[model samples]
Target: MAYYKEQFVFDDGKPIPIIIRNYMASDLEGMIELQAKCFPPPFPTDLWWNEKQLQNHVSLFPEGAICVEVEGEIVGSMTGLQVQFDPKNPMHTWEEITDNGYIWNHDPNGNTLYVVDICTSPLYRKLKLGQQMMQAMYQTVVALKLERLVGGGRMPGYHRFADEMTVEQYVQAVVKGDIHDPVVTFLLRCGRMPLALIENYLEDEESHNYALLMEWKNPFHR
Candidate 1:
């Protein structure tokens, strides 16, 4: 996995102990269960029904994707695609490999790295596991030398799959309606500002039918 260090272990050394590692083919069932708990409108492996996507996920960001285990049992996992957007090299960004089933891709600038999806078992919430996974994601994106990123929160308007809500609803959800989700706050506290709302971007009847288009510069650029 270009996004993560293969065989890397994350040990907070707590009571249950956490083991983060590359996912295996046999772990699909476990992955499915975790997804249902993590995401509200969980796809649960039935919608995509593509084993190859998971395979590619493990391969793309070996260290980026993590299967959490406590007492030798797979309790949860987190994985997402890293679409490198090298603004200076448009062709390379377009040449990047992505499973045909995956809808994400790196934009031309290569400054952006989009997180297509992320999940962790509900039981693991409040353990900072989600933040940890996000940190790994930030590191992976920065490692690729990206200068920007784009993503959105979930919504209720669409009530579909991933696109389940309006852009504002998703943002409010992401921030817990507190005006500051750790992710958004962290990014902004470091010096980034959001840009726009991509209106009517999808035609899916079940989709929130819209997405937000936000970007950030190299806040820490020296």
Candidate 2:
């Protein structure tokens, strides 16, 4: 994997330059657009940016989210939330509300890191910018001395729907769902393991799909 300063380009006339710049609230417009191009149904525009920063989410990154830019345009991004899921600082409010219940209470001394989202434009596939993003993401985790990092990754194939469909189209529709992304592949490439497979999970109405939880251990998290 390359560092933040490394620049790698593929033969497709596209260059992915890695930079540690923050994903400022100001960059939400570009971020949202890139997110749309990257995902079947990207996050809504309202949550893309906050007039004022919000905590308890990826926006908690003090350095802001990390992004990839190609020719001065946002092409990819990676963001994380800093949380310590100890008896003192639990992962969330309730236990049954999440799958974290299965994770041991090792967080008593371990800080939990949530990889909220890692996205990249389809035009830049196989370019390895996602690996760079994961490498940078680990740097952030190490800097914060986090113990566990968790996030749901799309399965290898999921149903994706089009904007509009005909009767026959809806009956035999081919949703452009993608279950793989650079970040998850990057984590696996970096020795992370797939913890479990979640089925029929959806973050929202438009995002009905399954996901996997990928995790990496860092003894250096201290």
Candidate 3:
């Protein structure tokens, strides 16, 4: 895919220029650095990405792997693969979905666009770069004629209520609008919904390694 550039207007009436483009070998250092800044230490054991893993993902589905740049610095990125999964039985962890970071399970002809990660630099968080990356992934799904977008939505606020309620209870509360989970709330506002609660999706203390199996069907899809 060719580079896609656009300007987004901020609430302050200032325009921020950004480019959404395919991942390149040269972006490895910036991508890794940006991810580190986005997700700090004291997190999961294998929640980070490496050069080899990125190479594998790019080799498998180059179009699904995309990054966002501002003034030539990689600030945000989202990775995904075409996959075939049953919506009723979507039981999976992050490792299993991306094949333990190897991403060899990518199927180009699959019916679903399985997004793995969508992150943005801390410096650019106020710019809504993460949402932009998601929009880029959605455009990819449309371009590929996929049925929908699927992924694990991390609940950034789940850890606060973990001591008082079970994971299921927390998820149900979020779904019913009783609670506001940062990640889940954002996904919901983007027209996506959680199908199930996934456990051990990662090894993070914030969310207790739990995630939501989120899906967003293509409304324009036939």
Q: Give the top-scoring candidate (TM-score).
A: 3
Best by lDDT: 3
What tens-digit string does per-residue lDDT give for candidate 3 at 103-169? 8999877999998888888888788877878888888888888899999988889889988999898
- lDDT per residue, candidate 2, 42-78, as tens digits? 4465544233432222243434267887777878887
Cα-based lDDT for every prediction: 0.50, 0.53, 0.83
Least well predicted 10-residue stretch by lDDT in candidate 2: 170-179
Candidate 1 lDDT over residue span 1-222, tens digit each: 333332333446544456666677677767666655655564434554256666655555454456666566666565545555543433211113334425345233444665555555666655655555555556655665666654542223334324554446656565453443434454444333555544554333433445443444445544
Give the candidate order by descending lDDT: 3, 2, 1
TM-score for every candidate vs. truth? Answer: 0.58, 0.62, 0.91
- Backbone clash total, candidate 1: 14
Worst 10 residues of 1 by lDDT: 89-98
The alpha-carbon lDDT assigned to residue 44 of candidate 2 equals 60
TM-score of candidate 1 on Cα atoms, chains taken together = 0.58
lDDT of 2: 0.53
